[model samples]
Target chain A: MNSAETALFGLPWWQAFVGGICTIAIFSFLYKENPFYRFFEHLYIGIATGIGVMATINTFLWPTVLKPMVGADRIPFPDGTYAEPYNEFYLLYLIPIAFGSLYYFILSRKHNWLAQLVIGFTLGYGGGLAFKATFNEMLPQLEDSFRPLYVAQQGAQSGIDWLATLSNLVFLFTLLTALSYFFFTFRRSEGGPAEKSALAGRWMMMGCFGAFFGATIMARMALLVERLEFLINKWFPLFFA
Target chain B: MDSSARQKDSLAERLERIDRRVVYLLIALALSLPIIFGWKLPPAEMETADSFFRVVDELQPQQGKIVLIASDWGPGTQAENKPQTMIAMEHLMRKRIPFALISITPYAAPFLESMPRDIKEKLEAETPGETWNYGTDWINFGYRPGLIIMIQGLAKASDLHEVLKTDVSGTPLADLSIMDGVHTIRDISMLMEFTGLVSAFNYWVQFFQADGYRPPFVHGCTSITIPEAYIYYVSKQIVGLYEGVAGAAWYETLLTKKYPGRESGTALKINTSLAVAHVVIIALMILGNIGFLVRRGDS
Candidate 1:
């Protein structure tokens, strides 16, 4: 094996095995609670946090900060390509990073004001963003929902067919009834029409929930199967070999 | 008999219904046997899958400066995301598409390292003449912690090379040949995100589209996430979407169809497991209902 492969395997065997074992151990917490699982759980988070901070600095802050200010236009490469001329706007990100760090200052009465500048800008951007995206996403869906219960393809009797219309009508009812079920203020109104509609709405909502639940369970099962494959196919087979 | 003995008897009966371990064993058998035998199922194309393929196919790889791949999943989700990552990279490779990867999650770094290398080696071994080079053809930006802020930074920044200085290899991004034509998010012709979380895609749609710059966006997301993710597909927020292993298998089918003799057994194996799991789960649900009805009748 080359140095790279050696380097990968060079990590203490115990450490590698423990790391792999710890993953399964932590997963076993889903079945029951134990200290071993909890210990690894905290360790994983702590290690991940440290690594994350290091990567952020190495990948973002350093190149975006120290390299541009101090390091020259040429840095060594595997292919020996020189660094391009530095741009200044990269440094402006430091302001947000600095402001974001002040969130920890909430404990102190004096330095806490610094946090709001960051929070306020975030809130403002988030609000503007939500307003814009909400319209962009929802408006189109709303427009598409008004389809005339059937579609027609060229030179075909496919347009406004009964089955197509029936399905579309069912879809429309499900959509509206599910929406109406969430109407809390009109719950007390007991007209025959309203009550009948509300009961239908409740059943429609249940169907929606069931479909949602089934889809969710399937997805979770897929994820589980994926993990099991990795453990058996990638990890265990190698270990045995 | 005492009340407690009666309770114990009832609990034992419930336990005797069927050993849960037996269920686990059945699931294991279902997933493993087909995979071991290299079984391939017939493709059942979904519109979302079709749309995903169409978007990827339509990208003018040579014209597009760089394909931006958001690899936001970690090893915990390697089961699904690994194949998704491989298939995407393979597609990009076949098209001579030079791509750069960015990760918004912390756990993504290790998987990012392993995934590209695995694909590169596989491409080399399977098609010797079709050598896919690393550091030149493809680059990984590794993992950045602040997802929303980092993506926004990328969106606004005019020069990504100058902004995020280094590739995943620790080579300066400026030094990499792949960054030559790419500068901003706008310069990207296509963006493909393979994520374990639905919210990451939601974040992409919200933040990226809010800036009034929407590229032909495609997603490879987890199966559980597809329903919510499909809503975006319906709304046209994303151009196309792939759902979990089935999605990965569908993508694999497309890839092998376009570029024959590529190493693609992975997707098929995963999909077989899925089909069996579906059958097993349906059976369990029916049995569970039967048990409930039988108990009600007895009472």
Candidate 2:
């Protein structure tokens, strides 16, 4: 094993101590909600918020907006004379900034119309994007929904391909029935075909929900496992291992 | 009551009234024991991970073809996304493939900044003679504000250098050897997005792929997003996907298969821990249901 690997396993004693304490504090919620956990939780939130603000300002605003406006170089004219280093046209960036600032006007009773202008514009723009997004994103998936019912000889050369055909058939059935379940325009009697199909659709939806819930549990467990690993392998190793 | 009858009564009633703390402690123990004991498991290879690996494996390094890594995950998803990113980075570094990392989310910048360092150390340790330089091999474009707008800008920009003047470290894009032929979205060989949000995946598809400049797109998403992601996968929108930790474990197994002696990293360990934790949870559920049935019978 390399020195780096050893160092990774053998974290400094103090670091391990702090990590262990924090891990315990977070895990203390399992026993009951306590002050230590609450304190650490608040600290985490404060640090996260602070980092977010600084990252936004430093990484996004400073580079894209501030620097471009304040640090533009002057272009030489035909007469060999130079204008101001920063371009005067860059001042136009303030227009959007001014508009964005109008959102703060929402606090006022009389001038809340100014805030609505920004809100309206944002909604209009977002809605347009959403319209475009719905087309581009969903349309292709809609097209792909057209799966072949029968397998071609060349396509089903392998057993796996035949299984794929069966899977596609199942998919098509599920899709149709699920759509039927959502079709609430017409009411159907207990023994009607539509009612039966809708019932199947409900079952299919439940299966999908079950899969989703299982995935969610797995994801959460993965996170918990990671934290536990850190505490056990990385943190406890300093003293115990 | 007889002793056997009393025992039967207690078994049903006790399980029904089991403390939440006991369950929590069991879960905690189940997760921690595997790690503490250094238990390991062989991860099964999946078609999804194989598809993802095949794309990266086929790429020729040092050919001016670059992968754009759209990192849209934060600390909340580090357990899943971080390992995915690390594995991808390790593959790229080993192959000497030049790539650019960019983030649209606010919290992703700092998290991604630490990646290159980790990759560098791993590469140096694994391959002693091989070298990977920052500007020449990879570049970090920190964080951008707009998701859709940024994707649109990438697609529409005539000169990517002009659009993105400096990288995360305030270095000029023109100075980076990695950006030699990478000028626009069309120049990108492929895109691998590791995101926690389904909306980000949709935006990537809407702006980058469906907007005409279609690169081979791969997605690594949280397990919660996998159900939604399968729709895109079936639609052939995303060429490959890694569905959280299980997917990551599969990829690691593939990596180990491709290059022997590669350490089975956190993914495998976490997968085993998760397996045990899941069993405990399932047992708890089953017991709870049994208790419910018994209580109902008594009523």
Candidate 3:
């Protein structure tokens, strides 16, 4: 590959080197506190927050709010290719959302009714959807909870998938025991099997926690790797040694 | 530190050992070596991952309907969520189903916010020959605050046009023919949520289902917050679940199965890094346990 192409994709390159240096610099805080790492960290946060705000406004408000409200023809395109005339009534819907934003202003100054309007609409909308989703999704799920302990289908490709059955039993046991462990309505025997099973359930949950923790660590590590690649592969190739 | 003194102690006492600094150094070396040498490992599919793939496999072109992807994860989770989102979008694009992208997360707007309009621009920029247009193939409902509120609005079909109309760049939802007949969240075939929050799944289930919406739901969340999700999965709140990097790797595998050459190189790099990391952590946990046992024996 040409030097330009090498500079573009290779390690010991510009973006990759810069990104790696930044990553290492950020990680250095683990060993000792330093102002340089803190500065880069803060810059990262600020840039991310700024980009998020700009992107949201560009994507959501423009098309959903301004385009429909002002009519699509008003929003300009680079070559004037996307100017489509739109209906006018769409502008009326922005009133509630605008009123909703006014709730933040009320936090510093207390007029209960102003905040209520936003909360009422938000809750009403959220409540209505939550209600619908509960039955449509959860009711069927509740019914499925009564599944047979085991099922056998003819001509199954795998002869008795033990893990499937075992996993189901484990799932069922953990669910019940965990629920029992939190049974606060009535007092429990101090050292019975019920308590023992509950303890087992607690341990099971801990095991799951360990796995989850491991996966989380991997995810964070992956993020670090990506950043390092950006620095090493794209930013600075000279420091690869 | 003497052997005669150690022998008098219990097994746990003898096992209880080693300073954490030693672990820190060893872990640092383990993680750094793979990167320096470019050592990559192969990833094997797990059962949960395989089940997720089977669900995607079932959603082929013959289904004649597209899945709805609610990508509420942005740059903060770009490392984890971006790969899955890209793979999911590629799948939908290849299947010829006109999928829609929506976001409820405040942080995630940059990636999908101008996507609908940008998709049109991008298509024009890349492939001008083939016939394609916005609203016909894909629609992006721009980022909305009030996470639960927006989801509810979706559930009830209230102000479907209004909701779509309020997009950031002022692109009306009605401008697209693909959205012409759709009024509610239930109108879509399946709903896939890629989030870092469990509340996203919880709010979706409680509100959307209570409203008579019956689309099968799938979820992808950060690994740390996924065990609780697995419980929900056992209870059947979510049809399939993909947690963190492993889930992303599984999704990549499925994507490769369908579209062989679309961004496989990056996926491979990701899978390699993940495998190496997982191994590193498992070793750390083992070392941690061994140290604990040794210290206990000494006591």
Candidate number achieving the greatest TM-score relative to the actual structure: 2
Q: Give the TM-score of candidate 1.
A: 0.84
lDDT of each: 0.73, 0.84, 0.65
In Å, residue A32's CA in model 1 sits off its true spot by: 3.7
Which lDDT tens digits does candidate 1 get at residues A1-241?
9975674576654455665687688767665789988988899889878987887787656655565655453555788665565566656767766778888777779988877777787899888867865776578688868867665544644444677678778878877776776677765467666666677899987776787787676666666676666566555754775
> What lDDT, from 0 to 1, does candidate 3 have?
0.65
lDDT of 3 by residue, A39-155 (tens): 989988897788667766766566557656776546567986556666667778777667978687667556766777787877886677667666755675667666556644447
Predicted complexes: DockQ each: 0.43, 0.70, 0.35
Restricting to chain A, the TM-score for each candidate equals: 0.75, 0.83, 0.73
Candidate 3 lDDT, B191-286, residue by residue in tens: 888877777767776655435455777777776677766766766667777777667676677666765544453444655766765676676667
- Candidate 3: where is the Cα deviation over 4 Å? A1-25, A44-141, A156-166, A238-241, B1-40, B60-65, B113-137, B158-162, B166-169, B173-187, B209-211, B235-237, B257-263, B288-299
Q: Is candidate 1 or 2 superior in lDDT?
A: 2
Q: B195 in model 1: Cα distance from truth in Å?
A: 1.1
* lDDT by residue for model 2 (B118-193), tens: 7787777887887788898889998887789888788788889999888898888888889988887778988999
Off by over 4 Å in 1: A1-16, A69-101, A109-118, A155-164, A238-240, B1-22, B25-29, B32-43, B156-166, B169-175, B184-186, B210-213
Arrange candidates, best DockQ first.
2, 1, 3
Model 2 misplaced regions, further than 4 Å: A1-20, A72-84, A153-162, A238-241, B1-3, B295-299
Top candidate when judged by DockQ against the true structure: 2
